[model samples]
Target: MMNSLKHITCAFALAALLALPQFAPAAEAADQPQRPILSVDGRGTANTEPDMATVAVGITTYATDAGKAQNDNAWVAGEIQKAIAQLGIADKDIQTRNYSFRPTYRQDKGHENEINGYTVDNTVIVTVRDVKLTGKVIDAALSHGANEISSLDFSASNTQGVRKEALRSAVNDARDKANVIASALGKKIVGVQNVSESTGYLETRRFAGNMMLAMAKDVETPVAPGSLSLSANVHIDFILSD
Candidate 1:
């Protein structure tokens, strides 16, 4: 009787263990139903006129003596600054961008290691708050001992409003695309799952080469303040529902 009772208890335990459910494999679990998502990209652009300009002017001088080279460069730079200031530009707007004093080497076969002369370079960045003064500033700097015009760039003073407008347009474009896709799939967009964005603006750049600087002293420089294009891009992941 004792052996029979023990056998019955073991059989009951084995049956209970077999009744428990088995776990599915990872691949099988992945095949289960999931929420549908739609991803799309949208772009928008806004145009606005540039309101300000920046000019980079430099003076370079070479001499056998380092002190003379530095002195000549400083004098020329000071004259250029004075000319810019006379155009109603405040002292704060004129900033020194770069200054370098280095020795030049003779590239001849017999004197490759000999120091030929010393060179000094001084560059200043001038901000013209008024767009109309862009040409005047360039001409003034060139006429007043500025030998090198590195770069000139035009930009808007305030880009906040235009950027916001572009962002709104980008969002609208994304929504329109999402709606079209969802309608084609016999589903409706229920909500937005994720969103990401990037924004940028293009500047109107003008480069003044050596020839342009040489001729600028004879004629008034001409500057065209072209419009700037600000762009926004957005990626949206939308949830779809039947």
Candidate 2:
């Protein structure tokens, strides 16, 4: 009888242990305190004068003979290249972009497309380091048989430096605004909890160099690079203490 009573007691203890509830993640999260966080976004922009200019210049020619068309294009392209070399621009700055010969088409009164002649085009992309002489380069090319101008883009030579400056400015801006908000709410910043950045750059737009000459200028084509802007944005989370 004594042995049976001890066995029963042991069984009862084991059953009590199995009936106890498990402590889970749901219960742990309820015990945690909510942290006071201040969130803000800040933006900064920096503008500077561009120092480099890139222009696409080319010559297009048409002739009944395919060989003649290519020859004419090469001759005119050669003259333009010589003029560019005389301007003290480095040989590496001139890069041949496109050279092609295709059949020219004409639509007759019957609405049928007819091949009238062959057209040849030769183009070069030039990177001019001196922004001030952008107008002179355009003038030189036009005077020497560069008839098709596709695009002109201006930008700074040292873009990395400008980008860093913009990011630093963004961080400073975030700190300043956070300080203002915290002071207004009767709180102080205990420390920085998180930081994130959103960076952006406005791609430089292309300008038509040929159209600029239509402005009736007796001198070299006048070009104004204006200014380029480098921008950055940052989001900061600061822990608040009151």
Candidate 3:
């Protein structure tokens, strides 16, 4: 009986310990203070002379027969390619962008457009290493029967390097603005809380009315590739203190 009583008492003690209520970790205090912050956006632009120029030359030919049209276009395109090569452009820089053989249609009285002849257009995009050679390169292609300038653009070769400079300027601009605002409010900026950057791009302008050079005489074509603008935007949050 004594042994039985001792075992029963031990089991009751173990059951009492297991029945205690459990509690979860406490969450953040509800009355905590939020740090005062100043949010600002800054924009900066850096301009650099472009080192490269992109131009597209197109050869268009028309003939009654499709084969003749293709042949003429191919011959002119080959000549234009040779001309560009003579202008010191690398073979890799010359890329074929478009080739199309389509039937030309003429409007007939009270009828659907009638097929008059076959037309073939072959175009190539060329990147000029030197901006000064843009005019000469176009003139060379024109002399070889390239009649169309589809697209033209100029851009800085070292865009990333230029962009880095722009980003630094933007950050500096943000800090300056923050300092001005903080001084006005009689508060001082203590620390940086967060920073973010937007997607930046290079802005290049097109060469306007440049195709008219094909009609001019032996004069060297004048091309002015204006400065290229590299821009960046930054958003910053800074802590404010009294």
Best by lDDT: 1
Compute the lDDT for candidate 3: 0.84
Q: Rate residue 165 of model 3 by lDDT.
A: 84
Give the local distance difference test score of model 1.
0.87
The C-alpha stretches of model 2 lying farther than 4 A from their native spots are 1-34, 110-113, 209-218
Model 2 lDDT, full chain set? 0.83
Which residue pairs show collisions in model 2?
A: none
Q: Model 1: runs farther than 4 Å from truth?
A: 1-35, 107-109, 201-218
Lowest-sum lDDT 10-residue window in model 3: 21-30
**What clash pairs does model 3 have?**
none
Task: Indicate the TM-score of model 1.
Answer: 0.75
| Model 3 residue 156 CA deviation in Å | 1.9
Per-residue lDDT of 1-242 in model 3, one digit per residue for the tens?
99999999999998878765332222344355667899999988877889999988878999988899999998898899999899899999998877889998877775557788999988889999998899898888878898777667898878887888899999999999999999999999999999999747888767635544443344666678888888899999999994
Worst 10 residues of 2 by lDDT: 209-218
TM for every model, in the order presented, reads 0.75, 0.80, 0.80
Q: Where does candidate 1 clash, by residue pair?
A: none
Candidate 1, 143: how far from true, in Å? 0.7
Estimate, for each residue in 28-116, the C-alpha lDDT of model 2 and write its tens digit.
88898866899988888877788999988878898998889989888888788789888888999988888888997777776457778
Candidate 3 local lDDT, residue 105: 80
